[model samples]
Target chain A: MISIRWFLTLTLIALLVLVSFLSSLRGYRESMAEAETLFDLQLLEHVKLLGLLNPASFLFGNTLVIADSVITTPAELELSLQLLVVYQIFDREEKLVIRSENSPTENMAAFEPGYQHAEFNGYSWRALVAQDPLDGHWIMAAQRNDVRYRLAEAVTLQAVLPGVIGVPIAGLLIWWIVGLGLRPIQTLAASVRAREAGDLNVVELDDIPKELTPLTQSTNDLLTRLAMAFDREKRFAADAAHELRTPISVLKVQLHNLLHDLQSRQLPDAAVQTTRQSLQELGQGIDSLAHLIEQILVLNRTTPDQYMRQFTRINLLALVQDVVSNEFEQILARDQIFSLDGLPAFVSGDDTALRSLIQNLLVNASKYTPLGGQITITILQEHNKVLLKLEDSGPGIPEQQYAQVFDRFYRLPDAHHDASVTGSGLGLAIVKHIASMHQADIQLSRSQNLGGLCVTVIFQAYQQDNPA
Target chain B: MIDAVVIVLREVLEAMLVCCVLLASSYALGAKRIWLLPVTLFAVGGALLYATNLTALTDLFDGRGQELTNVLLLMLTGASLLFYLAQLPGVITQKTSGVTPALYASLIVASAAAMVRELAEIFIYIFSYGIASGQTAPVVSGAVIGAGVGVSLGIFIFFGLLWLGKRRCLQVSAVLLSLIGAGMMSQATRFLVQSGFLPGEHIVWDSSWLISESSLTGELLHALLGYDATPGIEQLAVYFASLLIAILLLRKLSVNQSLDVDSLRH
Candidate 1:
């Protein structure tokens, strides 16, 4: 039920985001740390340059050195120093000789050659102390902590920006790629869905992916087994019919000869007359058996798998007229009224199958209808579909039994009790199989006109390019 | 950026864990579709409404309203999950074609409740920082990362459960729900204590030194098991008690319900 395509796409995109973004975060942190170290080295280099400035020689005299004095006088000075470095210079004796305006008039750090954190001028600073080797002046250079942190963060953000922006694009590509990778599966499914129930052939796919090989193989194996099973069933029915036909024919002949011989003896005994009646009954039973075998063979031939599928365009009205002409004698013998009325409709189907389908419907109608009842056959072409309807004035089938009657060997409960109607229960089943082979639909309902069973077989009309 | 990622990740993971567990449970029960679309819409709509009215909500109950509301939501989610667990074993063992509407409703409610609070918090956090500081780039990037990890982990867990097969999935889901429900119950107690609804506080222990709440492993554990480095005595009592009740209910009710069904058939 889960769509492998969507699952793979979403999961892959998520994993990409997780891995790439986490790495970017790590890169940002590392870049910031590196930037911080580089800024510290710059601070050290600045302090060395200040040591070379040797500000003590320019002082000329003792300068007032302030202690614990916070610079709060000039707002502009503080604002400038917030983004710039603050520097201070001191003599070897720790007296402040020169200082930036933002710096207090005090030694920023102890007169030692090292870096240290100190609070002065109401701001925290990273101060580096280095002795002027030439003039022995203790020089200090410092940067505000906030300014350094801002610089590091800005630099790192620049490095991590591209990865953040590329995520949406990567997600689109992953979706497309995952769908592309799963194409074979979709193709296999579509091919299987397009097949007919009787078309149990091994599935053929081009460029099958390795992942789907086993699946296709298993499906093909099942199809092969099913096709073989159906073949066995068809052969069994056909073989039994063939095998039983010979013996039943011989029995019929032998009984006919024996009855003829008995009659030719010209005996007037009562037992001889009884023997004649019994022989007649036995002959009828044998005829019924022979009819059953022939029906079975027709059923097997109409099976879609066993059909040859050679189709031709024929006028359905013309075919129905021919079948009615052939079956009219039976309808007349029963004193039943018969009618074949319709428009000329062209249908593409196997000739023999269509003939069999029409004959079975006509026979079933006549057999079920009472004497002097009406049987109607109509063929109509409506909007590219041809509807073949057969109705009879007989005991109509129940609505619930409509679907069941199509099944092979299935008959109505009333049919069993009506000994007058002799049937093999294979008429409608054969009709259904042939109709399906011709790609037609069969619907059984109570006839509105004749008040009995109505069977409708709808077929797609044949479209001809050239009309005479 | 790191702070944004951590904050968003924690909330997303918590919500995703509950959704994944509920989804897995529905899958185990042979549900074809898990009402995902409706559930997501409900959760998101509720979260948006809650975030928009957050100021009004905070003003109520003398500014302890959010805590009290959170406590209620957490408790409701825990109870719903327990109810869902109660029906799982029997339905799974019986091999029903689909989950019953009642069980499905309970799962949807539990997932939506788990999600609304967490999603609202993320919305509030991201928008406030994005508008106030004008730092959209870093914050958005962090959120993207957090949501990615959380969603990915949830998908992994969902598939993992599926791979375990139906029976084992139900069993594991039951145990997982018990633990998660216990965690929610424990969290509810914390919120109550924070609102001063629960009396004086008592510290059970503090293991922040060993595993800080901000670390990666700690955050994952918090989302999965509701791990608290500094769990109070009240939270511990509620956690264990709720856990025990969930386990007992899942085992006893499912078995008894199966027996009842068999008896009725007889």
Candidate 2:
């Protein structure tokens, strides 16, 4: 896939360079054209001057100038094409008359009416031939071949110098400007990433480009729909539970009356025993149903999609520490030695959700562990992640059933066969789902130290600038 | 060095902009993505033509082959753009236009031709001046910097145009596109005169006395809108004709678009 930003930036820069080169090229060509025209004009001016000089002393001057040409060696000044200009004059009979200091002793060119490139002495020359229309005197102005090229190059370089210097600076400015223009998108993405799953508040961005306004609005709309769906789901579960419990309550009352009536009218011992056992099983089944209903509601409420709780910055250690304190009686009732250990780790999460998650894990540990067992909760900041490890002393779960245990209706084989322990089988499922919604990682393993189930949850830890 | 970079950057930006304009227009019409297919095909096509005709093209019309080819491409792009504008929602044959094969096909042809033309120039140029070296390093670095700047600016412009409310955005695009088409046509005519394929009435108006074409502003305007310092009679005629036709087509499209919208509402 092509990254639009990268593609656009690179392509534009290339195009800019090519265009600039073309501009320089044009400059170079134009400069050469101007040089040619200017040199031709100079030749024309020299022809007029040559017409002014009389041909009477032409032999003596030509001899003197040709003698001086060897001494002058004008070609040595390659930098200044100006110093290389050489001119010669001829009478109508093609006899050499006068010449410039550097002019060749030999005739420059055939008496052409216009420009001609020819060789004289040991070098090439660009010579323009102009004849006097009336007096028929001919004047030829010539400059060395290298001189014209050098002049053109110098002019071209002068014309292209600024381009060579300015493009980089312009490019840098453009890069910075592009970044500024594209910042809104980056900012929006960062803002969305920084929040927890529970954060369903409308995103707020100010002074973003007008184009991104609709995108933000749409994102907010999606959040709204999700929140409404969660509300409806939560409402349905609570309403159904409320309506169900009442009928179950009345049914329990009717069962009680039937038992009393049967007891008052004495029957055969075996028959009475069978009726009582049946009544007991029916009551147990209704209790389990009530428990299941409660667990299902909690599971639904804590799922990320249904999560509607508000987050508060809190010391995770302190919060979990309080939970242990509240559940101390239940732990002690099982004759378990419960311990809490860790520093005051900081994190942000929904208060009620975290409390329920902690309580459910604690309850499960206490219920499952044998009498005189040990339960330990550890919390601390590990790197940037806040880790919480809860270990219990009991027969550790089989390694393979670890994942299956988090399923809503899943119970361990041992728990299922042992009728002495009762469970709605939804505790860990709720814990896993809620932890996920909070963006925490959860791992279930056999505790190395306690020789029992270990539940570990890792939260992304962050500190408040000012502790309140 | 700076000159090489700026020249390349300008050409690449032209191609990039052509792609952006077509894609943006396509998205606005709620169409399937077909522009890339044509663009890629034509890029390869253009490359093949350049590669095969390297000698022949250089030798054509007495060594004016590249110029003639560029001129032809520019005219093709202009025609494609005109066709697109003519089919805007309510214009004649509006029923089969907009998101249909006609519209997307034209967009593809227009954008692809522009890209192929520009890319071929870039390929030729980069090769003409080899990699960065003792004499070329500065130019190469300048090219890199220019690339960054050009792409950044292109993105800014692309997003900025997209941000403009839909109707107005398309309108602004239409206007600029007309200017661009006309500019290309004018440049082609100028080349034609240069190649002696057309009569030269040099200096229809001499703006060079006021501002030389070699100056930065002059070069920039020339790149963006083909502003010539001393435009010839042929260039003026072609530029005006292209511009007028585009304007007329755009007006017709705009009027028809409103009618289409009203009919839909009813």
Candidate 3:
């Protein structure tokens, strides 16, 4: 695609050219007018000068010497020729008196009858007839049109040529100036081009043009975003590495202990029992690894760019009931009391993702709540949105840590010590990401009545007929 | 003629210098493969400049078109300068593997290539100018020579400063960039002024001793620097405000970097 710069430049140059041409034409026309006026003035002056030299004899041809002197002089001949061809003079009876050598070979009788003047053969001529006061004779003068037209042409070309030459030069200068002016943009592009993926630092383009201030600022804004993205990625990788290492280390240590016991040939009953316990611990470690891998997959899938969830109308009450039923095993094992309430609500979301979301929340509540703690899942319909509330009678999250819980791999400091209640720490982040993709909002608060953590997922409401 | 050629040559040489710097930097940073990006851009820019004979293009737009073109050119120059200034620090601080070094070298080469492209554009401009003016070869040739000398001198100055600054163990890239940015902003502002998009107060202050609007020198200065003796109010305001903003931004950046370093030390 042609960039805006080139498009703009070409458009500008074209506009300049057009303006130049019109102005040049106008200028040409003006000059032509001026030339005509000047020529008319000269003609009038010549007529006056001749009239002062006894116009009657000159008109009647009695003053032959004077007439020949005026017409035949080299200067006078040259001046007449320079002005145009086809000059003529006539008497009152319309008798031809004087004619230039290059005058058209037409019968004088034919032209004498009519006083009408017109242009012919690429030349415009003016004819004037005046009667002599002394002899009752007439005088006429006529000249060709080429001189005026030629002057006009010359004026037009002169007016246009500078624009012709100057515009391109100006254009080139403009291009160069544009290039120079765009030097900062080029510099900006180059700067951006020069950056490595790891380099998300701020761009400090100190001397940018005013026109490019917005561009520079936007570019800087992009850099800030990119930096944030990079930081997030780096942190994610670090957290993953740290989290994965613990289980692997535990498995390694258990295997090592079993090998040491076996090597000592001290296969006492106590030693056998200890080896079995070590094997069980290793199995548990492997299980944790599997769970971590699953969480990672979920985390990756939940990335907005990776996969888009299909939205369909889902019954909130039914979805909640299903999730609670699925988590009954864990709830029963932990002896946590679970209940559901509220009306049937409809929400727009991907069913599978929603189920996963609800299941995770329920599992999280089950795990975090103390034994025999009560869990309540409620579905409520509000104006334009459906709310799914999951409340647990566990130790409520600290107010400060509520926001942090949604961050990937963020486990509360106290939660880290409980190895019995293992978690991948990506559940809330996955939920948040999925929620965002569905245009839903999730919030954490202290359950006023439950005296525990209350997590709410708000979804856009769906009408019964318009499922989408 | 000399004037035209000199202008062409100057622009080309400057373009080349930038290309060289980018290519060298790419090589140093081990990112040689990416050289094609700048090369492609330069080629596109050159082809566009050459194919659209400046005169014909300007003629099409009518009288005010020339001023518009001038403004566009000025703005482009400013943008490029600012961009370079912004990236200087990163280029200096980046750790280069072989690939990175190559990339840097390519970037410098691309800059040089762009400069050469500009040179070609300059020649076209001069030639077109000559044809339009109906001037004889002598005049055209003189302009060309003058332009060439100007370009050579500009290159020399650019490199000389680079070398001197390097020798002094100072990263003059940032400073040089700022200057270039300031210059570009001034040019762009001037274009806006001439195009009537902004008021005549383009010049913040006119203390030109050698040139006044009534003098030939003043006309030359106006052509070269986008300087006007009596500028419009808005133009000056925009220019000064932009300059101040750029300076403040740079200062803030520097302060931030220093604070980061201090915290890191702790």
Candidate 4:
């Protein structure tokens, strides 16, 4: 829910901006203070220079020169010194002896010995005064407030400019760097996302971060346990089916012996007849159990995860015909009609699984169809696919229950149908597993002509040069 | 530069905070990240449009057009957020799968309206000084700083919400969005009063002595909750009234929806 990309990008940018700006603000203030001091020192130097000039007006005894109009610079001159700075010289009597054109006639300050503020000529000035040690005359040097402020601010701004400009650039760089740092996470996620459902292998990530080691280790541990569990489940089913087979075979043999013994001894009593009927029912139950065990073995062996695949090209029509011929006796016993149709369709799959797939389907059709019912098998190759369809004229399953019937041990309720017709409930589940192993699709619906269940299995047709 | 930072930061913070809460709320409701890109693009486009047309907008309504329009936009955004909040509990309780189209639409409208309102102000502030005075570098730089801080804080809060998990995330987002929606309504009321569309001279209380609205702490609080040192009766009324309506709507929806067996079980 929380993206590291956004978090790191934003927070790092914020930190960079904050630290950069704060430092710049400090630099701006310090630079401004330094400039202010330098300006004051410059003002003092100007006054001292004028004192060292020791103009002739100091010796001209009460004579004053106040030249208000003068032109001394070229038109292209950038600096107008008069507008920026003004100065005045006074005699020992505090009388104005000589002054710049821009200076007022009166004293600019309080005739002081140090720097002071003065308002004259409708402009605020920072004036500094110094005494001439030779004649004790005074020289006052002043700079206008507006000009000094502009100069000071311009100087200070240059120092803070970098910080302001670097933020956006730093933001971009941080975004990229953070993304680079988080690449391992993205790689690990992609690796996990790309895995197949049955792939329970340990996750392998390149250059994984230490922070993610625990997570990866825990995930691998979980996968190891899951693989073991799946193996246990597969082995358990096969072992249980194998264990049940011997007992079931023994029951069949014992039942047959008892039936033979009962027939050999002629019995006309009603009680004896009931015993014979009971023996027949017991034999049917044993047969159902035996069929259930066989189905469980098939299901365990054909499961996609546990089954080892050895694919070879085989004609689907021949396989279906062979299975139908083998199962024809069951249909004949029930007085049901059977037919096999369609061309030879080549498919790539394990021969054992395909044979099991066809045999189970044929057996299921014959077992469910009523006496005198019809059963049809067809194999067709269309486009790049082979389709095997088995239709039976019997009580068809409801459309809604089609998906549920494929689940192991899930059977249709017997209340509405013939209760005598039994099922192991694992036939379709085994069929589904085998079909999936071969990358096939199964569809169940009502047969149009047979008016019963139509089961269709579609498989990719094997090409010689390009095996499916 | 400091002024620029403060201005841009406050606006960006307000908009980003709204986005964070809404994004968290949408995620809680099982909405996908598909809308985020398009919504952001649209919001930025809207901000540009509003900024470019600012002069024409200012000239309307006898020179009071901007304020009135801001009031309308803020009100609409607040109303949209309220609608989203009302649907939050129901969606979380499994009454629907993910966000419904109507809910998603509300989110889009709310996001765009709030983003445009906040970001246009920053664009206007930046462009006016940057272009006119040739101070583009410093002003834009300050904006970048402000935006960085605001977005960073938004991301932090978004992760904090996620760390709280789904149920608590929804609850916190609801509360945050309620306050934000109320703040928007209060701001809208202020705009209305400033434009003379609503008249109010009554100062319910002044807290400037304690927390001056111009201070940094005050500005952050203002961006978060529309903190006013001198709020009028109308402003107070609208703020509390909108907040109360949002809470009441959430309560009603949650209580009514909780009775459904499927909703409660989920």
| Ten-residue stretch with the least lDDT total in model 1 chain A | A59-68
Specify the highest-DockQ model's number: 1
Model 3: per-residue Cα lDDT at residue A96: 60
Per-residue accuracy of model 1 over B1-266 as CA lDDT, tens digit each: 77788898899889988989788878766675648877899899999998999999988999988888798889988989888887765555453354777788888888989999999998898888865677677777778777777788888888888778655666687888888988999999989888888873688889999888888888877777788999988999999998888878777756754454442221
TM-score, candidate 3, is: 0.39
Candidate 4: lDDT of A79? Answer: 46
Poorest 10 consecutive residues of model 4 chain B by lDDT? B257-266
Q: What is the lDDT for B226 in model 3?
A: 39
The residue-level lDDT of candidate 3 at A427 comes to 88
TM-scores of the candidates in the order shown: 0.87, 0.54, 0.39, 0.84
* Alpha-carbon deviation at B112 in model 1, angstroms: 3.1
Which lDDT tens digits does candidate 1 get at residues A221-338?
9999999998999899999999999999899989989998997897878978899999988998998889889889888877765454567788899999998899999999999998
Q: Model 2, which residues run further than 4 Å from truth?
A: A57-59, A62-81, A133-135, A297-395, A414-422, A430-468, B1-266
- lDDT (tens digit, per residue) of candidate 3 on A199-268: 6677777788899889888878998997798668856865775677777777778777766767678578
Docking class of 1: medium
Tell me how far the alpha carbon of residue A254 in candidate 3 is from the true structure, in angstroms, after superposition: 16
Give interface RMSD, every candidate, in order.
1.7, 6.9, 12.8, 2.9
lDDT (Cα, 0-100) at B90 in candidate 3: 48
The lDDT values for all models are 0.82, 0.74, 0.60, 0.82
Model 2, A150-187: lDDT tens digits are 56656566667677677677767767777777789999
Backbone clash tally (model 3): 122
